[model samples]
Target: MTHQVTIRNTGHRFPAQDGSTILQSALDAGLVLPYGCRDGACGSCKGKLVDGRIDYGRYSEKALTAQERAQGYALFCQAKPLSDVAIEAREVRKAGDIQVRKLPARVQKLERAADDAMIVYLKLPANERLMYLPGQYIDILLKDGTRRSFSMANAPHDDEFVQLHVRHVPGGAFTDHVFQTMKERDILRLEGPFGTFFLRDESDKPIVLVASGTGFAPIKALIEAAFKKGVKRPMRLYWGARRPKDLYLNGLAERWVAEHSGFEYVPVISDALPEDNWSGRTGFVHRAVMDDLSDLSGHQVYACGVPIMVDSARRDFIQNCRLPENEFFADSFTTAADKAR
Candidate 1:
């Protein structure tokens, strides 16, 4: 049985096949609702269930609380409609309006950005171009039917080749291949550009960009795209890593600070060793933000990287700094271990 699903404000309607989540069906029908870590770990797809019944599928308690569910909220990514359903959700317009596509790409080059991070450059067919918003990600389709998601590190304005910063996940099949076996000219199929973590251009609020480890990939894209569009809004980036070596693109960020008067870069190292002789901010990256900017009421924050860092920033900023809930955007990097839970 197929159930009809309607978006209350937009009046957009789609059919969800039996057992399919509302989000999956809507995306298949060309409606892109905000989402991250589609496995129900992120609350990006949470919305009001305006009408009709649904089977709320398995989801993390942190993503959808008991009180939220009792209040008629549902994680659309995990909710399957039992009947004709009406949902109230903000529809992303400009960034997600483009069609998702699947295409083949060849590895143009691979450079080691750090001991654990590899910068991969992929070239599409001569006539093919991927039109995507900054801060979106692509899922590399593996031969074994599983997919690994990596964000495009390059901005859309420089899209001659897609760039990805892949961290070697120990014992992971894909990362193992990328680090040890994958070679230049290797062909891979990919589907993208996904996620709703892009900049909200309508807001002129000063921006605070946060990234950790390889989570910096999408943040890099967002920053580059913002600069290319000549957005003069004050932008500050707080990049957190375990050690100084992990801030692989520190030079690039420093150059941005030198060239752009509106831009500021802060690198935070959490576990700097005595040998490292780090002389910058130390401690959790998000904490560094709180220390410097006591108030974030008028700022828009874009955060990506580890789930803990993203979650911490979202909670602390909204609870203490008076940042509006909607003003905080993030993409949490969830591993297979996280999904298993």
Candidate 2:
């Protein structure tokens, strides 16, 4: 039996099928909803359940506390409607603006930027272009039924095919395929323009871009977009990596620094092997930020990379660097291989 539910604040009706999450139905119908992660791991999709019953799928308690759930809060990604529901939620704008779409993509080029980093270029058909914000990411749905998310390294301009930076993980499923098995002329299915971690153009606050490994992908896109849009905002980038090899885009960043007057790039190295012949500031990447900027209360930070880096940076920036917690935006790249550890 198809369930009919009235969307809160909408005069229209929706057909809710059994076991399907509310967010999925909204996306399928082009009625976008504010969401992130879509795995019940991020609370970006959390909203009030004004009136309804739904099962809470496998979600982390960190995303939604039991207290919040009891207080009518539900994660849209995990909530499946069992009755007519009224959700007091944010309108599908900004991050939810781009409708989710699946498109045929072909690997146009593969450029190995570093010993362990590869920037893959997927070409779209002439007339098939992905409309994505600067910091959004797309999931390459693999044939094995696994999804790998990568942020667009290039800004969307005149309908260009999407771009992504893939870093090799020691036994990673997707990265291994990308480095060893993937090739040009390869066809893949992609669904996205997802993630809420994008630049807030409205803020003129001094920007601090923090990146680790290939996490710089989205930060690069965001900075490029900001420059292309002629944003004169003073921006400084603090890229942290283990040894110089991790920052494969060092030259590219130097070029950006030379071209942009308001941009500054600082490379922070965590560990330098003795034989590697390294000379750089050595410490936690976030600690480097703390060392440089004593006060980050007025700055907006966009950080990406390992969860440890984001978490550490967030904690330090708030507690030590004086950065407001809300101003610190992060995209944690949690890999399956890291799950075991």
Number of the predicted model whose lDDT against the real structure is largest: 1
Query: What does the lDDT come to for candidate 1?
Result: 0.92
In Å, residue 153's CA in model 1 sits off its true spot by 0.5
In model 2, what is the error at residue 179, expressed in angstroms?
Answer: 1.5
Q: Pick the candidate with the highest TM-score.
A: 1
Candidate 2's residue-wise lDDT over 1-341, tens digit each? 45655567654456778888878776666665666567766565778888767777777676678999989899888888887777766554433456678888999999998888898889887877788888888998988898888888998873465778898987788888889999899998999888777887778899999999889999989988898899999999988888888788899899989999989999988888998687778888788888889999899998888777886887789998888866877777766643331
- Each model's backbone clash number: 0, 0
Model-by-model lDDT, in order? Answer: 0.92, 0.81
TM of each candidate vs. truth: 0.95, 0.83
Once fitted onto the true fold, the runs of candidate 2 whose alpha carbons sit more than 4 angstroms away are 1-18, 25-35, 42-53, 61-74, 82-97, 158-161, 319-322, 337-341
Off by over 4 Å in 1: 9-12, 94-97
TM-score of model 1 relative to the true fold?
0.95
